[model samples]
Target: MVSSSPQTLILSRILTQNEAQPEAEAVLVEAGRVVAVGRREDMQAQFPKADTLDHRDLILTPGLCDAHIHLVAYGFSLTQLQLYGARSVAEIAARVGQRAANTPIGTWIQGGGFLMSELGLNDYPTAEMLDSVSLHHPVLLYSRDLHLAWANSLALRLAGVNENTPDPLSGRIVRPLGTLLENAAELVARAVPAPSGAQTLAAARAGANDLAARGYVSAHTMAYEGPEAPRALQTLAAQGELPLRIWACLPHQRLPEAAELLKTNSELFEFGGLKFFADGALGSRTAWLHPPGFADGSGTGIALDSPELIAALGREALELGLVPVTHAIGDRANTEVLNVYDGLRALARQKGLRLRVEHAQHLRPGDIPRFAGLTVSAQPIHLQGDAAMIGALLPQHQRTSYAFKSFKAAGALLAFGSDAPVARPDVRASFAAAVTRVADNGVRLAPNEALSVEETLWAFTRGPALAAGWTDEGMIQAGARAAFTLWDQVGHQARALVF
Candidate 1:
């Protein structure tokens, strides 16, 4: 537990984000709440008995908040065989082969984060390539976007998938034994052994602590994880072991169970939203789009949740006091989700809840304005790797992809995040991506869509706070929570400071 005694923090400067007092030299904190913000001498005189740790070289700001992440999944990813930067099929095989050599035969080897484009593959990979590396183990590696997975023959056999097996609803099994797209990935994934409850709790603790150590005070954990994920987080919070605050979402399939657990008021580990996927991701050639889809001849991507289902579930979610947070990656997906939100706007407003759309990666010009008054939870860091893909796959939608500036100008609240496990939750990388719009290939992707550093900071802090209805956070004021991020400078290195 944090110390409840009064303390005074003397800093070089505080970027309060509080319009009333935009900057301060020091802050007085008591029992995990800000008591005062003033000059160093004034605070020193006012709190004579208070303890002080002076950091005169650093800049302080409101504690950073990751608006969307899979907290437990990130924790597990930390321990998984990393393939995020594997440059070629050979490099990936080396890592898989190495892991296989150490593990006993027949064990499942799971890891991900390889981009199809990065692997220099013109077509989907085959299980035979993986078989060359791990003949005995059931190997399953996911695409960087998490929308696609590549499984070896053993893994495919274990899942009972063959050419005869028809594609699952809203998902596809790329033939000749290898890749799974969208919901189809679940076929092989379900065959993997589930993590034990203790493992889940440890992952929860690890992820929360990891983020907290990186200067985050809270996160909006988007659904896609199992029920045990949130249960573990709640368990941690109950025992005062959770370092960061969590705003969790339940999968749309679990809405009924969640509705039964809903309370009139929010709590520490709040189940505040219902998650839905309108389409798949761009990398997998599965993001639902309009006419003239991918330049590579993959048709307009797969649509996961139908508009009719979203409308019905959204209404039910709002009535039960839960926010409807949908994932819309492609332009058509965004258009469809917007249409559903239009109908539920009145009901959502009546419940004093804001509608949220995750990703919003690619948007049609006509539908861009529709995001106004809605929470646009986006990960700018994704632009680093997606720029080249966007240029190649959807050149027509390039201008609107990762449109951070346009969203804010459209009056939408932009909540920045890393979408960790998909991308590392590195704030510096997020800031760089938003401000520079520079891709990994040294190419700038729609530079006009880039945001100023100040604007990006707001998206990371104040915008997320508003999205989660966290009034006591994302600011440095007398009545606000005494949680802060001490930065070397505004967008430089940072660490959390929870009083």
Candidate 2:
């Protein structure tokens, strides 16, 4: 179905994503690499000996890349019970009840994608609410943000967690013995059995192939997943089963292990970042915020990783030729990370490394200019779900929520992603949300922050390529990979084209 050798393509239009030669009517490939790009007639005449494929009816552009994703986790989530649309506790219980019927007794039943707000709850769901429906089986469901976990009594019991259980570092065992926030969620999570190697490989394949099928030729896999996750992806690549190129990271704590990994790298996979978390997600009310954190009197949110460790580890990452990437959701978190980044700027520049801030979701006006020359790896699709939440929870930061345009103006390279498993890798949703700034409730969160179609495309393409230090990707030019995405329209339906 796909060709590995050279071929010439006659296209209706090619958005090159290269500034110098931004458009071309045709491209010539050899050895699965771009050889030339020019007028259709010129390419056809010059490459007469080459086999020609006519795609003059469609538009071609650089293949899409979901700059942020949890490949293995997304694969595992494919088979999990989905609660992304459940609006009430009864509905969620019914679904969990149905799952319990199918699952054997005492076995763990896991699923997620529900929001406390969507469930019409002002607070976390209690263990009692899920106790009866779980049929004595351990049940665990995560909030849409992945920062909060709702567990049935059995799951909590299995995890040996109770009201008297002291909270884990930077995490909380919420009241009533049902909700687990941040690191505490790991307790119940660790209690669940890990998937077998076969399952891991299968999930890795599923996640990569799904992205490839959606016209994504590359992805930047975050370090949120377990070690088995990257190992599975590596196995897939070694076997030639991986269809997408991956730029992966290791947690800051994994620096010792990272050196062993960096010893070897491949075309399809590379360890390029050292990941850090400055705070948790907004949905769980765990986002480290400034004074007057949550309007509902939730207090300033919890801080996770300390700044001192980040700076110390960051320098090591830079010395090791890896990017230092930190996740900052709340304004206070962003400010703190920026401050740390400022101190590292000299060493980072000397090392020719660019610091990256993931999410950059909420920001202060003063923090905007500081993002200059940094990478803002943001997910525009988050706006649709977070718009109302931002308005309700972090009102003071509303004007700066998902500030794409502002980041760009401040000299930050914008690399857009879906943050898969946390959100669907829907390009359409990303395009629409970034350009329209419209939320699910039909409210525009920050219209002034919206990006143009071209800008959004660059964020998805060139920006990510540059962010990952892949000069040959995210553009259609001589020496670039022959990968391209055929689209019905600029941001509409898309499919990857073979050589």
Candidate 3:
């Protein structure tokens, strides 16, 4: 016999999604992998001395995963002065002044979670208002998307930006208020001292722990910060302190260094995915769009990396056996990325790497089929608040806003997430938004596009696993990772159960 004694776990309902629907089956596990799965009697007789967890009333499914999230940034965001609910510019200034008063002079003060549309100011905020709060302290408040940044006059001075300062390529400094958009934000952010190593580690831990508490067993962390963020996660993994399984990406800017590191540390964490940005976010009105972009006439949003650049990088990444994930929210952005991906489909298939598009939030109905064989990493929670902005700003694209059902029906891999630091990664909220299709004002945006409970569950589990290329997880069957989630009800609360 392979072994005299084997470990067994029997649940009242084991949701093996491999079939037409979730089926109640018995799952046998040993040595951190599933040994067999069939009936309760069959498994019990096979492992007489094995301990069994009696979860007869709970629904057991694969552990949930977040497809797109910023782990370290979210962790530090948890500890900062939260301004997520500030209603007005005055309210935001008051809060910043209060935080500045307590901190020592010359120390950097950071806070985020403000929406440009909600601030009451039609245009971007200037540095003078922040200066009025505290000229001695350097203030940097990022818009919820991290694309737009509001800085104080003192911070601007330190960054060496002035009235005559020309805009950097793919970035702009909004006149009147010293706000930096996209790459422009880096000019000032780069000059600031980096967070201490210990601070970075603590932030990573905090972020990962918070996700675990919310029942997420793994996450595909998108690279948004410096290399140090991923380094902190590696340290946690080596120390056995990593709470959630992490698959991280590196920005195209650092691909050279990352490619060299892969020579020795390939298995430490898979290094075969490159992240690219096709455009900025909608909240900042920087999303590249087709003609007559925004109803407010903000001009057809800004484009970041061009299609040629993405295609060139896509080829480079493919040569290294890496997947290419581009961020495209607007209709034009999506069309361009799809074109670039079409050119590389053969190469991607040869490399066995699946390309991904983050935030396929708005799309032209005609292009829905383009997503077939690709991953759509999306955050449904954004639709709840963004519905109103869509109507007011991009009225033309409002009908297709956050088209979740359309993507799924088109054979695309739909992996859902919260886009934390922008919205709460609350599983309850995400489930509700996906299934209900209701906006903040109780108006249903695309009610016909609502997903079923089972479909939503797959997105939270198997879809993300497939997107991240982790076949060992996200399923409940023989030889799968012994990680699962127990739900009180199909669409209700959840808790992780790792063997």
Candidate 4:
């Protein structure tokens, strides 16, 4: 038996993503990169001095990568109250009351993971519901989609959000003064005290370590939080506390600042993309749809960050050697983004950069082929929750929803992720959602869109690596990173195996 060491010959049923050698029996790793991959006996004989890690009974695949996540924000949500399964507003308020009973009277309380439809609510909830329980404490809870926020009276007052306050462009202050949608949520979010630098660092560590614990070797963090978020992750990496290799993005609005770090890279972190949102999410009733809007009579949803802005800033992002990543959830939004990307593609190709679209959730059939040569960073886990909503809210678009197989057929580079904090980064959840197209409500959203297990695995691994431009990751080949995921069963129990 060989003892564990930095250099080891690991044996397993290797699913090498390299086209030349799709499978291998063994791999030789030194430092943190693969030195060679070949048959078990040949590798063992060649590297007799190298320690051996025998996992011949397990399956070894390229390292898993979450292509979209809000790392620091998700970390903070881990400690906050989780409102994932609540079926009623009263239940949510009770949970808040219990937390208030133990906390300081004036502290702000935060939580998320509730769907408007899941609660069986016919209308936007009122602040009075939360006010009844924690009158003194400011309570602010976000909808599962992160596009809608419900604030208690105190919190709304703190943010100076009143019934008469005009809604910010592309946002809504839902009447009766309790819910904030889209950018409007930021009004109250600003009032909540910021976590201290130490707390931020702790959260960064928590998120990164949590992903590592779940067998993820790397992640692409979306720019949903403040600059402090990425800074915290960088600091954690600098201190040797970060567990996952991170590809972080900055908001397109932060491109001027992003330009300074154009060529940033290190062992564990790199600034890779500029993120822009073309529209909001479905659960929040804010997906910018085409002519036929929400069936619930909620007119065509809000559009954020105009196409002009995306084109201008997106070109600028590409010039600075950054990927232009846009979040587009509706057909119209996707169409518009695709149109803008048409002009930017030439520049992106010249720079060896791939334009990326996040949450290309609902797309028109005509626009599907336009994704060729682009990265579609998506979260199938979201389908579990959005399934019923899609059927009820936008039935006309169901056929094209979560079109994973179609994306592959169209030559789009499909990458899977959990969009953590929006949903848990459970690999099985992603695998099941992609492979089955089944939703939690016992109904399949779009059966035709289901992906095969191998395709799903590719999305979770190599697809993300390609999107992030990480040539050395997401494959088991000489010169590739030695990070891998060992599985008892492909979609079952798994763990990170890094040399």
Off by over 4 Å in 4: 1-6
CA lDDT of every candidate: 0.90, 0.89, 0.84, 0.91
Per-residue lDDT of model 4, residues 1-499, tens digit only: 1235757888999999999999999999887889999999898888898888899899999989999999999999999989998999888988999999988999999999999899998789889889989898999999999999999999999999998899998899998989999999999999999889999888888988899899999999998788789889888888877778899898877888876765556778999999999999999999999978899898889999999999999999888899999999999999999999999999999999999999999888999999999999999999999999999999988999998898999999998999989999999888999988889899988898998888989999999999998899989999998889999988778889866
Q: Which candidate is the best by lDDT?
A: 4
Q: What is the Cα-based TM-score of model 4?
A: 0.98
lDDT for each residue of candidate 3 in 188-217, tens digit (9 for 90 to 100)? 998788899999999999999899888888
lDDT of 2 by residue, 84-173 (tens): 978899999999999999988998888888888788888888999988888569998998889999999988888899888999999999
Span of ten consecutive residues with least summed lDDT in model 4: 1-10
lDDT of 1 by residue, 416-473 (tens): 9999999999988999999999999899999999898888888888889889888998
Which pairs of residues collide in model 1?
none
Cα error of candidate 3 at position 211, Å: 1.0
Per-prediction RMSD in angstroms?
A: 1.4, 1.1, 2.6, 1.4
